[model samples]
Target: MTELLERCPVCGKTDLREKLQVQDRSVSQETFTIVQCQACEFQFTNPRPDAASIGRYYESAAYVSHNSGAQGLINQVYKVARFFTVRRKVSLITKLNGGKQGRLLDYGCGTGHFLAGAKKAGWQVTGLEPNDLARADATTRVGQPIEEPSALGTLAPGSFDIITLWHVLEHVHTLNETLDQLIRALKPGGKLLIAVPNVESLDAQHYRQDWAAYDVPRHLYHFSPASMRQLLSRHGLAVRQKLPLALDAYYVSMLSEKHRSPERAGGPLTVLRAGYSSNRYAAQHDGQYSSVLYVAERGA
Candidate 1:
């Protein structure tokens, strides 16, 4: 079953324009339409799979986040990238929190890598993962019990010092509801670190419909810097900083190339060229990274 939204989920605007159509390359291979809100410029997959049926789309062994043991060239590369990035993520959180360890929550913490890293850095960590397999894997990795998404509502208000969502926000079904809970759970001056793919990046523009970041049905919403600001502002949370995940372009470019027809696919050299170009472009233009990490804080 699928649900067709009548209004923009971010702003409740009824005016939406068709942006483009992309296929579910990972699972169903069914084509889905991407629509943009005329007012907010937020893009989303229209008539996406409903909450009850959406789990099927994520059941593939290739879904690296859920299938921690997934093996393949791409999955292996993703694991390697994660290995280096986790330390940086922990360092960033530590720096953001005045070099002190505090209570942290990793939302949608796939396989608990970040949670494990943060725990090693002396932060009390809680992980929330919806996928049962991923949650189990995370529990083993972090050596602690991982909670389900439903646990967010049960948390005491203003309890966490920092909360993070790494490439997870776009996959959320209840955007506003989830944000509300996260906000309510954050202590005053707490930070929300959200990393999401930038739909406005040079690579996304170059690939157009073939952009791998636009993983349809699974990534229900596509966010640009502008749209992200507007969405966060609605909850009285403002972006404090925007940092680029420089390594993402290369990985995303690799997938984007594979998404193109075999005859049109460009291999390693093409992937490197595309990744370098996107990063260079973003260096010259503010808020144009392939993937942006938004550090947000609640208003006074």
Candidate 2:
């Protein structure tokens, strides 16, 4: 067991209760305990691994690029369909915010998939990624090197019309500082979009320690809807809209269950059936939910 340094990232509250203990899903040797902040109701990994130590797990070739390998014909077709679905969703977001043309930044842009899509949609897109290989791929895909967020001081305050962190906020080491920087980067009335795992979901309850979305030291913080709203409000932002995210839950649950009991596989079909049913249930009602997207605007 790794002993954690004292302090809660969000509220600075030291009072914590042990929530769960589980083996690290990505790395076999590592184990972590989840703790809940008594003060803020925030669930996080105590004694979380520092950035350098955690980088090793992501060094694998599988972690380097989004296009890991060529898929089968059926998988390729499905991917094409999903691409359109994502494009349509981005279109809806643009429409909701009154148009897509503006300066946009995608924080933690893994392999630049969404950034590329946003660029195609007419936004002047920039990306921020800490992973070297992932950053390199993103730069290649976007035709420009993704800038480090720290180097973004060159941009005028409020320069961005839109800033997004897709499943990235929980991974930030300095959550408050990151949000401060983002708030500074956004133009007045600009939109900030954040997506993260929702601890309030039913999947969290059922899986407990085995929940893949918790993601241990890599995912330092787990946000409930209420906690997320509070965090945003504290940083001079207001939530304009929120929607439950589907799709991720299914894949994450599948991965989690597989990791939990690797030898107990009935067959691929059985695994697929379980994931499908769990995903469908979560989609229909808010059980073991995986992600939530928040759209917020800078406060006046």
Candidate 3:
């Protein structure tokens, strides 16, 4: 058994309450418990595999980010979604910076898919990816060497104009330390955009504990808007805006349906209906999508 988290990584409060026992549905059939901290209301997986031991949890041919050979109906769907998301991200960065040129860094840049698009958009792109297999593929796609996660705090301070983590923040083991590194790496008035699965979204409620986003043993932390705000505030960062990723609601819902039960996983039609319902809820409210993009800026 792995060591349990004694305190909230955000508040440093030792009061933790176990919420749910979620299984690693994809790779390890092992179960992990989710806990909520009393002081900060932050949720995270308890007794999780530490950084060294956790790598094995991600070792599966089906892990798409690391293995390009990961093929299936879900992987195919994710690839199609990636095509649209990469373009959307590029457009977002252009609008945010009011220019196509800037220094951009992408953390956990899986296969460097988004980096490739950012580079084409005239940004000097640097990518950090942990998986060796994925780094090789990313190099081919990004036309640059992707650095390892260990190189986070080693980067030049105040160098990057923009830093992004798309659906990657949840997997980070040293959450606060990693966040500090990213903040220090940003230049004054620089923007840091982080996208993570929102456990407060309607789809997560619909799927209950079966939501694929929980992804225990893999996803270390689950963020609510409140928790995220508290985290950024501690580092003197301010959340400029919250952007909902509409397309992610669909993808996450579809995957949630599959994760519910392999034998009883819904069909395409069922998944479509679930996705639509989730997106509909998000359209009516801001920062309520299944996955959310948090736009935070450093103090100028």
Candidate 4:
């Protein structure tokens, strides 16, 4: 069953305007509507499947993160990208800590890739994943027992030095609740790293409603850079830095073209051209790429 949200989850406002309708290309192929809050300008999917029913939506072999099922050419590319991205994430966290290691908690750590990388970098690592299949895979990969999503609240307060959510926060059903738990688990002055698709990016603008990153009900929320910052600030967190993920423009654009037209999606040459164009535009335009990594810190 699906639940239609009446109020803005972020602001508790009732005034929302319908922005666009997008179909889930990855799985069910059912169309969902995107709505924007008149008060906060935050956007989200309405009439979305509740947490219970939503798991069925992600039960696809193509959802690579949950399992090691790298089937298609796209999945193959995703694995390669994930490899480098995990290393980069560890490096970024190391840099944030002035080349030192600390306790790190990765929220929604898919398949234990980032957790494994962080562990190798000398940080005491822990992971929380909701998907049972992914959690089991991650456990084997990390060689440690990964906690379930239900374990978040049970964690000791102010126990972690850093918490990260890479392309995970948007999929969370409990926005404020999850953030609050994360904040409590983080020590004062610790960092929260979140990466999400930016609706205001050049590639997003070009793709419009067909942007693949707008993964509809699965994404739940559409966060522009400003909206992200605002959300963080509201929870007593401060944005310390913003880093653009250069690689996502290409991948998102490719998926977008595929979403736009199956024929366009099938043509290698067409996908390459569209991705190249989007990447070039993003690289030149003030660093507003496809997705952004926001480095936030809790105030002491």
Report the number of the highest-TM-score candidate: 1
- lDDT of each candidate versus the true structure: 0.95, 0.74, 0.87, 0.88
Give me the runs in candidate 4 sitting further than 4 Å from their true place.
262-266, 283-286
TM-score of each: 0.99, 0.86, 0.96, 0.95
Ranking by lDDT: 1, 4, 3, 2
Give one clash count per candidate, in the order shown.
0, 4, 0, 0
The order of the candidates by TM-score, greatest first, is 1, 3, 4, 2
Residue pairs with backbone overlap in model 4: none
Return the top candidate by lDDT. Answer: 1
Local accuracy of candidate 3 as per-residue lDDT tens digits, 1-300: 376778898899899998888878888888889999999888999988888889889888888878767899889888888888899899898788866579999999989889999999899999999989999999999887889988888899999989999989999988888999999999999999999888888888898778889988889999988888899998899999998888777788777777776787788788788878887887786657888899999999
Q: Which stretches of candidate 2 lie over 4 Å from their true place?
A: 1-5, 64-85, 262-288
**lDDT string, candidate 4, 136-191, tens digits:** 99999999999898899999999988999999999999899999999999999999
Ten residues in a row with the worst lDDT in model 3? 253-262
Clashing pairs in 1: none
